[model samples]
Target: MRFLDPTKIAEVAAKFMELSSPCRLCPRKCMVDRISGQIGYCGAGSLPSHSGILQHFGEEPPLVGIGGAGTIFFTHCNMQCVYCQNFQISRGECGEFVTVEELANEMLKLQLFGASNIEPVSPAHQMHLFLEALSIAARKGLDLPVVYNSSGYDSLEALKLLRGIVHVYLPDLKYADSRMSAKYSDCEDYVEVARPAIREMYDQVGDLELDSNGRAVRGLIIRHLMLPNDISGTVETMYWIRDNLSSTVAISLMAQYSPIYEAWKFPELNRRVRASEYNKVVDLCWDIGLENVFVQELESQDLCIPDFRNEKPFSWD
Candidate 1:
C-alpha cells in the first residue's frame, strides 16, 4: 500500500501534533501541552530528537539482511525501565536535537546508505514529528517500508493516524502484570494499554511479509525481552498474543537483558537472566504453539548489548 500520499500529509501531521499538547501519544497521557513547549512525561519537546542512526544488524533476521536494517534510535523513552539496555538514551542523557527538515534528511540518508527498511526506534511519543519527516522523505523518493519499532504502550488514537503510513510494526509486549510494570517502568496500567495498542497494530499490519532477499517489507513483529525471575511474565504475555491475537504472529524472544541504570539497586534485577529462565520461556513458546519464533542464543547477551554513550550505539563487531 502507498503511504504518505501527498494529499493526506497535512491532515496526518496536524492530528498527531495535537496529541502532543494533551500528550496522549502513549498510555501516559501526561497532558503537558507540548505544543506550547511543555515537556511531558516522555521528556520530549514539540520537535523530534535522536540518539543515533545506523545500518544495524542486531534486529531479527528479516530486518537484518545483507543491506542491514536502517535503525534510527530516538531519545527519551515513554517508559523508563530500570534495566534499560540503552540507559543513557532512554533517560534523555545524550542526543542531537533536530528539526523536521533534519529528521527527513536522516530518513533519506538511511535509504541512500542501502538500508533494507527504515525502522524508527522509540517513536511512540513523536508520531507527529515522524509523519512530518516521512512526508518530506517520501517527496524526496524514500520508498522503503517504514517500521514502527516501539515499546507497546502506544495509543489507539495515535495508531489510527498511522494506519497507512506504517508498513511494519515491531513492538515490545513488555509486561503482563500491571504491578510488575509499575515496579519496573512506573506505569501501572501497562498491560491495559499495550494489549489494545498491539491489537491495533496487528489490525493494521496482519502478518510478517518478506522481500526476495528475506528482508521484511511489511508486517508486525512482536519483541519480548525476558526479564530475570519471571518478572517479564513471559508466559502471560505469550498466552495473550496467542489467545487474543494469533499463534502465528512472529515473535522475537530476546535474551539480552542486562542490568544497567537503576537495576543494581533492585535485588531481583541485579543479575543476568539464568539459562534455565531463558530455556523455560523458549520452551513455553513452543508449548503454547507459537510458530514463527526467533530465539537468540544465551551467549548473544554480549552481542546484543548497546552503549548509547558512544557515537555509534551499535557497531560492525
Candidate 2:
C-alpha cells in the first residue's frame, strides 16, 4: 500500500508547477488565469491559502484514534455546497495565504504536535501548490502519511497527476443524480465528473490498506453525507459504489449534516438529516454488502459542525 516513491512525487510536483495560465483543475473548468493572480470559481489565485491547520479528532475512527488526524483547512472550494459545514472557510470568510515553503513547515509542525498524518481538506484547487509543498516536505524528511481529502469534483487528468503521490484518497461521492448536484452544488456534471475521477482513484490505489500498526498506508476512502431527507441521492450512489468499485473499499456513511451556507433557501436541506434518512442509508450500505463501512453517531450532528472562529481544526497534543 505504499504510495509513489519520493522521486516520483517530486517529478509530479515539477510538472504541476508548469501549469501557470488559465487553470482547469476542477470540473468547474473556469479556466481563469490563476498564474497571474486572477481569481476563478474557487476564489483562489495561483497560491494556496489556508483557513488553518490542526489535529482533527472528529473524523472517522480509522483516521482519528486516541490521537488525531493532521488536518489543514483550505480556504474556498470547487463546489459551493448549500449545506457546507465549513462555510466560514469555503465561503472565504477568512484565511492566510502562505508560500510553498511555509506550507512545508506547517506539515512539519503538525508532525511535531504528534499528528497522525497531514490531511489536506478541500485541496482540489491547490494541487499545484500542494505538490510543491509536498516536495519540500519530502526533502525536509516529513514522513507521515499524506491524506488527499477532497470533494469528488476533480478532473481525471489532474487526479492522474496525483498517482503514487497521495496515500489516502478521501473524497466524497456527493450526489448520485446530476439534477440534485446542480441544484445544491451548482455542478450539473458532478456525477459524470466524480464517477470517472473515483474510478481513476481506485485504479491507482485499491481498497483501504493499513500498516503493521493499523494506520492507513495507501487506499481510497469514500465518504457520503446523508442530507436532511432523501435529497442527498444516497441510495443510488451507494449502489453505484458497491457495484462499480470493490466492496472492500472503506466507506464512511456520515450523518453530520448541520445546515450551513445557503441551505435555508432549499427546503430539503434546511435542517439536520432525519433519523429515518440516516437509517435508510445505513440499511442500503448493509444491503450492498459493504463490510468496511463507518457510521457516525446521530448525535454527532451537533458536534461535527465546527465553531470555525475559536475551535481551530482538530488536533491532539
Candidate 3:
C-alpha cells in the first residue's frame, strides 16, 4: 500500500489533519473546527471516538472466511437513518475518544487476534483519525489490509486521499431516489452524493479481487439493503452499479433490514423487508447482469444485535 511508504504516510496524515480542523471530512460539510473543540454534524471531533473493536463475522463472505474482518466501530456518522441497526453509536449516543496512538494499538490488536482485514465502520466522518492512526500502525508493523466501510455519503475531495490506502471499499448504496433518502436518512442528496462517491471508490479499487483461499485481497463490495415497499430503490441502484461501475463488481444484497431505533415512527419502515420484496430485487440484479452478487436469506432478521449497554455490541452465528 502507498500508505505504508514512510514519507507518503506522513504527508497523507498531514493532508487529512487539515480537513479535521475545519472538519470537511464528509458531504455534510458542517465546517465546524474540530481541532478547536467544536463538534460537526457527524458527531466526531478532532480525536477518534470508537464504540468497539473486534473480529466481525457478519461481513460479506470474502471479508469473513475463517478469520473475521477486523471491525472498529466508530462513534458517529454523517447520516441518521431511522432504521439503523446500530443507532446507538451512529447517532453519537455511545463510544469513547481514543488518542491516535491508541487507535494504532487497536489495529495491531485486531491483527494479532487473526483478523483478515481492518474495517473502520462508519469512517466517512473520521478519515483524519483513521489516516493518522494508520500511519502509526504502519510504523508499528500493522500489515493487514484496510477496509473502508461507509454509509456511501462521502465527499469526493475526502475520497481522493484514500486511493492507495484503502484495499477494500465496502459502501452502502441505500437509496437511488433522493426523496426516499430524505424521508429515511435525512440525506436528500444521497443519490447525488453516493453515485459519484461509489464511482470514485471503484476507481480506487476495481471489482472485488480474492486471494487463493477466496478472501478479499482488494477491491469494492457494494451493499444494498432492501427496504420494505420498494422504498430503497434496489432496482435503480442495481442498474446504476451495472452501468457506472461494472457488472462484475461484488454486491451484497441485504435482506436484514429490521425496524429498530426510531423506525417504529415511520409507518413505511416499521417492518422487515418482505420475502417478495427481497426476491424481486435479487431477480432485478440478475436481470441487470450483475455477476458477483451475494445474498442473505429473507429471514435474516433473527440475528442478534449486540446491546451497547454491555461490553459487546453485536455478534454473528
- What is the TM-score of each predicted model, taking all chains together? 0.96, 0.94, 0.96
lDDT of 3 by residue, 78-176 (tens): 998988888888887878989999999999998888898889999887878788898888888888778889999999998898788788999999998
lDDT of 1 at 125: 83
Error of 3 at 236 (Å): 0.9
Task: Give candidate 1 regions above 4 Å deviation.
Answer: 1-4
Which structure among the candidates has the greatest lDDT? 1
Ranking according to lDDT, highest score first: 1, 3, 2
**Candidate 3, pairs of clashing residues:** 306-313
Tens-digit lDDT string for candidate 1 (1-317): 45447546657878888877778888788989887778988888877888888898878889987778888888898997888888788888988788988888988898888988888999988778888888888888878888899999888888988887788899999988999999999888899989999999999989999878898877899999988888999888899899999999999999988887899999999888889988988888899899889999889887777877787777643
Q: Please, what is the whole-model Cα lDDT of each candidate in the order they appear?
A: 0.86, 0.82, 0.85
Which pairs of residues collide in model 1? none
* Candidate 2 residue-wise lDDT, 144-250, digit = tens: 87888999998887888887678788999988888898889888899899989999999988888876666777789999888866777888878888889877889
**Global local distance difference test of model 2:** 0.82
